[model samples]
Target: MAVVSVQQVSKIYGHRLSLVNALNNISFEIKSGEFVGIMGPSGAGKTTLLNMIATIDQPTHGRVLIKNQVVSRMREARLANFRRHELGFIFQDFNLLDSLTVRENILLPLALDKFSVAMIEQRLAQVSRVLGIGNLLARYPDEISIGQRQRVACGRAMITKPTLLLADEPTGSLDSKSATELLQYLTVINRQEKATILLVTHDAFTASYCRRILFIRDGQLFSEIIRNGNRQQFFNQIIDMQATIGGGGRYNAITPGH
Candidate 1:
């Protein structure tokens, strides 16, 4: 079954004379348990498309559906509740509260939703074990390495067992080794927990981690590459597509204008 569906969606900015189409009639489906990547050059509307799916922005035309429901049309209160429970997000920044212990931060969502103490502990244990942050739980955010903090962020996102995971430049802040470590953890999360992930990245190496990739250019679906063999071969394919689509160079996290 499809876990996410984007049907003929478009995002327009500005008035009639100055109108800009950030996305143009894009359509795709991400199947259940799929690890999908969205890649494009800057200003290609990658994040804009993701924001619509994140329920952070509405599409100017068309709609977004998750798990067969029209999320774009949901009422505010219900949408808020749904978003809190069903959608998980990971960004380049750790976004952890400085004052809270790693354990506290990971459990914040369940606490807010009033999950029973036993259940919260259960979820936390499972997530931390997978992410390998269990050893760092009692420490504050500042006490861990950048990689460890990112792992904690992953734990927090997975603790909810969200229907879909959205990630934007999640490895932007990490060094080569750190990036590889986090990616390994993510792959483990996807296979072991069957979490559906949609990640936006400009780096071919980062895109290579996905099972299938959707490439865009100038706000449209330009091409796609599915990993057919080993990771090395998949990495080469992603790099080739990046070159073909005029995308290469170092990049950081998504911005407001992206």
Candidate 2:
């Protein structure tokens, strides 16, 4: 079954004066255990679309459904609770708390939900070992390298065993080598945990890691390409599509007012 469904969604800022359509008549579905990429040029509403799916923003019209539940119309308090338990987020900046130890950071979600100490410990053990951050659990965020920090962030997101994982420029802050490594780790998580993922990135190389991609332009889905055989070839195809769509250079992260 589809884990996420967006149907004829649109986002409008103002009624008439100074109006902005962040997304227009957008529709798509992501199946369970699928790794999908949303790619677009700057100002193409990739993040806005991601925000809708993440339950961080409600669309002006239409619906967003996760596991058959309507997310856009959910009350704020319930939505907040649902997001904490069901949806996991990985951001470009890692978003780890500076004051907390790595172990604390990874367990923040469970702690917020008041999971038992024993349960939290079990979750941390499972996720940390899978993400390869178990060794750095006692250290503070500042004490770790960028790659390790990103892995910690990934562990934090996955510790709750969320149904769907949302990554917004997850590899943006890392070097090329680190980015590749992190992407490989994400693939492992997707396969082993059977987690559905929606990745928002502007880099063709980043999107290549996904099983399929949705291309957006001017707030609408322009195209979609499924990976056929080799990932290296698919990466080149993504680049070619990006170039054709006027995305010249690599856009590692979204810049406001692009």
Candidate 3:
């Protein structure tokens, strides 16, 4: 089943003389357990499209449906609840609260819903073990390395077991090694936990981790490439497509799984 259905969606800004169609009738569906990526040059509407799916932004035309519910039409209060409970997010900046310890940050979602104490602890252990942050639970975010911080961000996002995970440049702030490790962790989360992920990144190496990719250019769906072989081959394909479309993607010297 399709976990996300973006049907004939479009977003416009300003009006008349200054009208900007940030997204133009974009359409796609991400099925359950699929790992997908969106790649494009700056202002190619990658972030705009992601915002629509994330429910942080609305489409000026058409509708976005997640799990068969019309998100664009949802009332404010219901939308807030749905976004909190149904969506998981990992941003470029680790959005953890400094006052909260790693454990508190990871448990915030379940804690808000008033989950039983036993269940919350069970989820915390499971997520921390999977992300290899079992030892960092008591430590504050300030004490951890940048990589560990990102991992904690991952844990907090996964703690909810959200139906769909939206990641925007999650590895953008990390060094090469840390970026790779986080991607590996995301791969494990995608496979082991059967989580549906939609990642947005211009880096071909990062895009290669996805099973399929949607390349955007000039605020539209320029083209797409699916992984038919290994990560290296997919990386090459992403690079070639980016070149053809004049996408300004960096991290060129790096190779995936090398």
lDDT of 3 by residue, 8-50 (tens): 9999999799999999998888999999999988889999999
Looking at model 3, the pairs that clash are none
On TM-score, the stronger of 1 and 2 is: 1
Please give, for residues 1-258, the per-residue lDDT of candidate 1 as tens digits.
998999999999999899999999999999999999999988999999999999998998998999899998898898999899999999799899999999999987787786787888899889988888888989999999999989898888888999999999999999878888998999999999999999999887778789999998999999998989987778777777777788863242221122
Per-residue lDDT for 1-258 in model 2, tens only?
A: 999999999998877878999899999999999999999889999999999999988999999999999999999999989998899999899989999999889888887676777888888888877788888989999999998899999998998899899999998899887888899899999988888999999887788889999999999999999999788778777877887787654344322112
**How does model 1 fare in lDDT?**
0.89
TM-score order, best first, reads 3, 1, 2
List pairs with backbone clashes in candidate 2: none
Worst 10 residues of 3 by lDDT: 248-257
TM-score-better candidate, 2 vs 3: 3
Top-TM-score candidate index? 3
The residue ranges of model 2 lying beyond 4 angstroms of the native Cα positions read 249-258
| Candidate 3 accuracy as TM-score | 0.97
Better of 2 and 3 by lDDT: 3
